[model samples]
Target chain A: MALLIAVAADDSLREQNVGQSLQERVPGAATVDIHGLYRAHWRYLVRLAVLLVDDTPSAEDVVQDAFIALHRRSGSLRDPDAALAYLRASVVNLSRSVLRRRQVARKHLKVAEPQTVAPADDSVLVRDEHRATLVAVRALPRHQREVLVLRYWSGLSEREIAQTLGISNGAVKSAASRGIATLHRVLGGAPDA
Target chain B: MRDGMGPDDIERQLRDSFDARARAGVPDGAMPPPPRFATAGAAPRRHGRWLAPLAAAAVVLAVVGTVLGLQSGSGHHGQQPVAGPSGRQTSPPVLQTSATAAPVDIRMVPVDGATYGVGMPVVAYFSQRFSSAKPLVAATSVTVSGKPVHAAWYFEKSAKPGYPVEGHLRMRDYWPAHVDVHVTVAANAITPATTVNFHTGARTIAVVEDAKHQMVVTSDDKSLGVFPVSLGTDSTPTGRGTKVIMAKQPSICLSGPGFHGCGIKYAQQLTFSGEYLIAAPWNAALGLRDTSNGCTNLTSADAEYLYRHLRVGDVVKYPDTTGPMMQVAGGLGDWNVPWAVWLKGGLIPTG
Candidate 1:
């Protein structure tokens, strides 16, 4: 089930009563406080950003920037239920911008270096094949890569991915299918008879 | 590693892969400190609004100062000073032209900071068509990792009659992966000064042999793997030379003259014409004797392995061929054309 976190401006009566049913269902999941929201979602959001941007420092920066933006705009969002969605969207958008900026920096900056893939002990974490999969996924087109990562990594359903990407449900489905097909081909998997 | 698995199995493997990578990367730790946010109902901070205008005034003063300095420095010339439209005595027209030859407005194709496939050609668009390209070519240089490479500028005409012309620079071969390209367009007789930088990601090259019926794959010059393959028949020979992997498909049905619903698996395109591919025959043994409509056929396993590893920028070279090599415009066929021939492809007219 998706988590809904309300970010209200203050602990006023109007804010309290805004989503009584959702509040009871999730039990204080809605947070009017930015710090509280950050404390709650920072880790997961950072991981998500890491998957998208492929680096921890940039990922953390992206997540932190997302929170700062959210905090600044918390007063404007009437529906507190949209807070988590806003954060997710912001993270994705910021990640794209980071990649774009990185691309430009790479072109002009002499200090630019290719991102080194951290070598992990195979016995402790990923198999060679799994790591290969990750590399292949990184090389996919942006839309296809985003859809695949959201669907498989985050376990978000097609509908959720569609909402997160602001694309249609059909687009999500096609992207997922295409991404999977590409992955299968890359991974040396045989087609179904 | 089982056969007949469907998309669901692939999805499960992908999920497992992503989870494993995440587990290795994200550590279990306390949440990092968040940026300071405005307290409950505090107004957001606003900086000075007049800073922009102040900066503009400073720039104007600097430009005027430089122009006046130039005029004074040229005052000793015996020629009479020219009168300006505003009735002020200005520097000679020649000196003014030298000072105000608007720095060539240069826009590099790929812009600054674009990641292109290995087949990308560095193109520079000039605001005006250059009368001579020798100065521009002499001043410009393309380097990889601070080391220079053989690159030449070809003048490409504007698509529309009156549109500005462009100079396209290309190396002799496809770019190696993960290398930074530094482009310096120095201020020269034909164009103004500009610098462009770009990067190529992960170099994957596949060499195919029709006579030997083998395909070798390499990443960053290290051999990843090799596989036996079937090449096109005598009637339909695969074109030779270099091609970039354009696209991939898991399975596609081939249909045309003299062909039925013949299926190919793990198909990666090599030509922009969509005519040739490196794929495996559907439901057939991979190493079977050559029989294709000008495509290199691989085993399903090999095809999938390549599909997983090869990206859009990766190069595929056909060293042995029964037919002529493809043209430069045929799918990233930049490597097929020789450096001298490629140099002539640009807009500069030969004397």
Candidate 2:
């Protein structure tokens, strides 16, 4: 408990003058790269969002909103490294709101459980074991999918994941434990304990 | 590394199939039409589902000063209806017992006037285990800001003998901020009878987004401030979890890796493994890069401000980062253990 850490923070400021270069970055993300990165990562993000939101159009909307939020928040970012993460987190949050909106919309419409997402003809669907797995993954609760997808897709650490999902680390661990358990069973890889 | 237990194969397929399907669905240049320019000001989200840590105990040893053996155990077992705090909230009730009256003192971790965060637990320390916790358990009661809470007792497993057996207690959820916790333990027999009190300060929680190098502090659904920080480096990564402030020090010496220095100011300890939030004016890349041994490195000015404003038991959460997960027993990590599991107690059994 007594092993004191020798590391310090202001040391970097003295040795390397990185702040001046950071100023150049603040204005850049606000204009050029917001559009550039949005266009570049749009397809990838839409695809990822679709897995959780369960459709392409809604997923696209979620990504767009996320990009716009990122643009607004980018000024505070000193390092460009945080840009993608901020985008990923925004998407996750926006996806939750979309899900909540759908639940309300469904209740208002008195329609089916809002499952008209998968395209039918030449449906972006491929029939195979992976499809079955994907179906099961999608069918799982949205929060669980958020945990699994963020963990598996974006490769975020549990800490970053909690920030992204606005949940606790313990909740993250619990969701992962339960999600992984269900996936093992769904894929016929493991039986009940 | 996935802490505790996280399987690899299932996670790999989740990625593999996701990547394949995404590529198959969207061919070259098939991006959706650019979104409308309006609606950029995203509505602020109200985090009603904000899950916080268990109550942080700031008065672990203060009870020892007033620990007095109340009386011999009548052996009612585990369910002891404690005598309510007599003369509730008039003048501080002065117990009529000597500190050394009992062989083993029943100490409440309720520091008389210290304030902690919402997640602070109401803890009791037994110098030695009674035949059962009943004698001590029944003699204890807790009220938060004058409202009675049916707080139950969960005994803890000491790391070793002579380390004081603990009876941990908390409400169903994290405590609300700006409340006072009055814990009265009348250990009539096992050891001493003492009533100690502690305050729950603001429900302050700091979430450190590692990638962003931003530490955001919030209290009661309001944003307090955002400070730039440089977290631990790859070699000595900062472990992640919902951690509580265990202590504060004005100045301390810290040495890790290639550096060794003293006069480091405004140190607030997070974990027992030497993780801290401290002043590190030496790092040029305060928010640009990870540089410290494992502590959260902040500017000296920020550190001093936080040291003064933040109290022991205030929560600081680190989402999954490059580091490992924190262990429940590592420091004031009781909050990391799920509530249901926490209810089951540790070492000592309820059933």
Candidate 3:
């Protein structure tokens, strides 16, 4: 009973202090336990999500949903370190699910909505070669695209990509290699030897 | 010379042009997440001690649950499930195996084709059509020259939750050398078990279909065709960004990226300068249509044909798709830059 009572007091104080500190920093932060997590990872998460979803607003939503999930599963994560991986995995899974659903939905809308396949307005004035290069990177597989974005755009290490994507490092390497080769093929270039 | 025009002069212009393109597509109100998480630094230290125990627990749980399920359904069966520590009720177990009293049908596939790369995924679909229910396959042992192989088995297209053995396979190693890799599955002795023999040569790889009609492509030689591809599940599917085909080879090769839970070698590869690879496993039918992370997709047959015809200097392009489209002769000629430090130009956006 004494140990139980002691444990209860400790839990309450820890919860209270964490809650109070977070609330002081951001209004309504009390509603979200992952405020710290969000503060730490929101930028990178948004970047990764945007690379997948393209739209900024949707990327933000994806990150926010991931944070919410983290908050709900805070108790299940006995170790704080797993929190980031768990969050990244959640975001990727959710994004993939959304994409699959969108593909199915696109079928219904394809007839009614004229398929307008135009390069972004910005690409118009860009030099033909530059446009070609950007287009080439865009052509890689979804997984490879994310890896390249995370590696180059985000500048994260391979370990980070594997963790974020919930795949083996081997898988990450495989995706990266295949993606780059595909880019070289499409862009008609050769790798630096 | 004042403008620094050289062999890569066109590339400099292209880089600037692409930089502007990135700026133009920059959507409003989209903020970049921080580069990494705070928890990352301390994760390894904390979990290092618990990994073994966690793995054992997982294996035990998997074995017990699967064995029980099999006994109730069929009296004579050999069941093997990768178990962990959560007793009988925990999360899903990764690998499961079972031998049927009656002959179980087994099929084999080869990782070959024009778009073959080191990490390309080659799937084998096996089935024994019965009058009563959906066809079932019994794959007892699968290997490349006697080396045990772990594969995800499913009766459906999508990798669903429970099919005993269904998930990604890490076979970067153990591939047969220039010969047929045999796969055998024991049945209850009803239907003839199947065998899959794969051969990857320096120039082309062959995908041998089983009695049933299933296609698997693999190749060590870089002589494959261009396949339309799309990014997998990442934020920037492969074909969305700037890319170029940087290399060509006639064989498969895998490299390690030095991360945890990943020690397997890779597959046939095509490197996109400053981007990722397009492995074989994910080559076909995964929400991609002429778009990929940064690679191209080609049908095995098309790839084989292209492999024979296309040269190293051939160009590719992506008009309105995620990656680029092949413009072997001219479309991308204006952008090829060999003597540039573009990777370090800081023009490439930070993810």
Candidate 4:
């Protein structure tokens, strides 16, 4: 069988190991990817991770790890487009790990972290009224948020989401549906917890 | 997909929101410092935060992600995993069958039919909430005098005492300068048809970039002039959004925690929180610094000029500030809310 690419290759996903290094430690890679793909793919990947991780710095860290993983494995990887896919999958998985541990820690330690009160700078991008929806999205159970963001934000297919999250296609579809339903229920005027 | 509302609208909103956040992620030209991976050979310096979390994350993520088959699924039972577009649950169109219920009534805001600024939003305050906003959205129509525009009704639950919900009419962008706005609501089982017409006087936008401590004013999209100004102090930061000048006064008393002065002139209300743009001769050194209690302080002459030209509903935008984001429900901030999210309706959709 031909090398089965689980997720379809997007231009960003296909953005080959940009320059000599795509690692977070490589400052030179910033200059190489700065013009086009940096804005498009790099920033996009970071933003995707941001929604998943709920902070810009953490999102950056997630993207860095994904890129490092991609750079390390690009030698054996014949197809370059798969690099982006590989990076994307890494981000999703890494973010999931971060959130799960955080959730588990919070539950165990009972750490009342200031979870959803978006910092003033975070509000700079999203307006006050729209903050509620983003907050609502953030409030969803972990897996549900991931599915909705991947499906809607990334426009990933069910197969793509399944492969990325390492879940069944049926699980992706179920999570997407439940996520949307949860969004509607939460946003559709249920002024309560 | 349930008449395109099953998951399409919500999906579109999520896409739009995600894209907006992505675009607004880092300030322009402030890309993340390049990753130090190639040289570091070692894992990027691990903060105890990520290092600790990654351990548990790795162990759990290593499960080949059996799709949560291990945990009992009864926790979220009542909210039976709803099938999105990918699954079986189609959103049944909300059916309204009560014939005896009173027809929903809507009235146009600024019923006096006066001229307003380009930033003005056409509001139709409804008497009560309706199960479906379909009728209200369909009944309401806005016709611009000069340019052909595609304006839509964004319905949201209004928090006013009497009116429970409202459908605000706005183009994806601002109205053209010196154009008439004619809003016609067709009387239906839901709302009585009524027409109200108002005019947009000028295209004025005041952008306050806090770093510069100056406001660049524009008329009809052309730079009118740059005026030195003083904005909110550290404690009282001004709202940061494209907010409309909701109301204006020639002179007004200024009062706050420790400051009290009457006859503070050229006051324009920016937010319901009492943030204003006013003439402050008291600030001996205006425009050179940030020291107002949240009001944008301009020289009396400049404030007078603004008062003369800028009418109610003109825009005063703070492009960069560490301040609160304005809510349209609180003031004339409908323009600031992204059109996509606005289309999702509001924080609280119409009941």
In terms of TM-score, how similar is model 3 to the real structure? 0.30
Question: Which scores better on DockQ, 2 or 4?
Answer: 4
Per-residue C-alpha lDDT of model 1 across residues B69-185, encoded as one tens digit per residue: 233444423222122112212122232223334433332222345454576555443334444566666777779988998777655442210123444567766676788888787
Task: For candidate 2, write residues B249-271 as lDDT tens digits.
Answer: 67766544334467898888787
Q: Candidate 2: misplaced stretches above 4 Å? A: A1-193, B1-57, B61-103, B107-110, B159-161, B188-191
TM-score of chain B of each: 0.54, 0.68, 0.26, 0.68
Residue-level lDDT tens digits of model 1 in A1-193: 0000111121211211121211212215444555546655666787788778876556666776787788778887644447778889888998898788777767777464453232232213344566667888988999999999898878888888898999999999998888888887886553321
lDDT against the true structure, per candidate, is: 0.55, 0.59, 0.35, 0.58
Worst 10 residues of 3 chain B by lDDT: B54-63
Put down candidate 4 lDDT per residue, B18-50, tens digits, no spaces: 654543453211233324343244332221111
Which residue window of length 10 is worst by lDDT in model 2 chain B?
B44-53
Tell me chain A's TM-score in each of the predictions. 0.74, 0.69, 0.65, 0.69
| Position B64, candidate 3: lDDT | 10
Best by lDDT: 2
